[model samples]
Target: MAAPAPTAIRLHRQRRVLELTWADGRRHEFSCEYLRVFSPSAELRGHGLPEPMLVGGKRDVGIARIEPVGRYAVRLVFDDGHDSGLYSWDVFDELARDEARNWTRYLERLAEVDMSRDRDVVKLAALVGQYKPPQKPGG
Candidate 1:
């Protein structure tokens, strides 16, 4: 598979989804959950010998915030408050290739671990809320 070019990439956040536009003008809608599960950070990738993680409870994952990590990457802050992973050009390229297969394997891994992404997502949100103060009504 040909690797994607960073020069041809653009990312737009919309509520719970991100719309990515390639230089070639092709666009794709990717959710925060999809991006999170596929994060390239060591927390999920584990260095060069990256040990893949089982990301469950992401059926409803949404992007709560976004931080540009540089011209080469973007940190995706999930609604669940997970903002550790930094996605790079290389990693995003890999994600674009046969993403269906990758996602399928993730689901399988979740099952193997007896976990549910959707349910775990709910738990994560709850935990983060415990430490962070409640948001203002219109803030």
Candidate 2:
């Protein structure tokens, strides 16, 4: 059976959600962070390896834009400068269908690596252009 085409696609930046409606009347809402971490790009998926790269510090990432790729996929440009993933119709369907399980697995992997979905503190400091060392008292 052919994959159902998206009848509508909406990116809600305020809510950081991608809303998609399929030709078969199914609707799915995907978080921007979820889509970023699960990007189909080789940078994340790594040549069909058993273990894909773990992406972190994207808790507040948003979709900057979505550009059509041919007639079957979209190139999602993220706020963090990731623009390589091509989200195809079949890929979107699969993501929507497996969101729950995939999310759980992702969270588990994060825990195993002592990582959090929150932005990395070091990166945040760099972005802010300052790193103040902790003060030492009683010199």
User: Which tens-of-lDDT digit does each residue in 1-139 have in candidate 2?
Assistant: 6476798999999999999997777889999999999998999998867755888778899999999998889999999999999999988988888999988998898766567799433345344666567788975
Clashes of each: 6, 0
Residue-level lDDT for 29 in candidate 2: 97
Worst 10 residues of 1 by lDDT: 2-11
Model 2 ranges with Cα > 4 A deviation: 120-139
C-alpha lDDT of all candidate models, in order: 0.69, 0.87
lDDT of 2 at 130: 61
Cand. 1 Cα-lDDT:
0.69
* Residue pairs with backbone overlap in model 2: none
Q: Estimate each model's TM-score.
A: 0.69, 0.83
For model 2, what is the error of residue 44's alpha carbon versus the real structure, in angstroms, after optimal superposition? 0.4
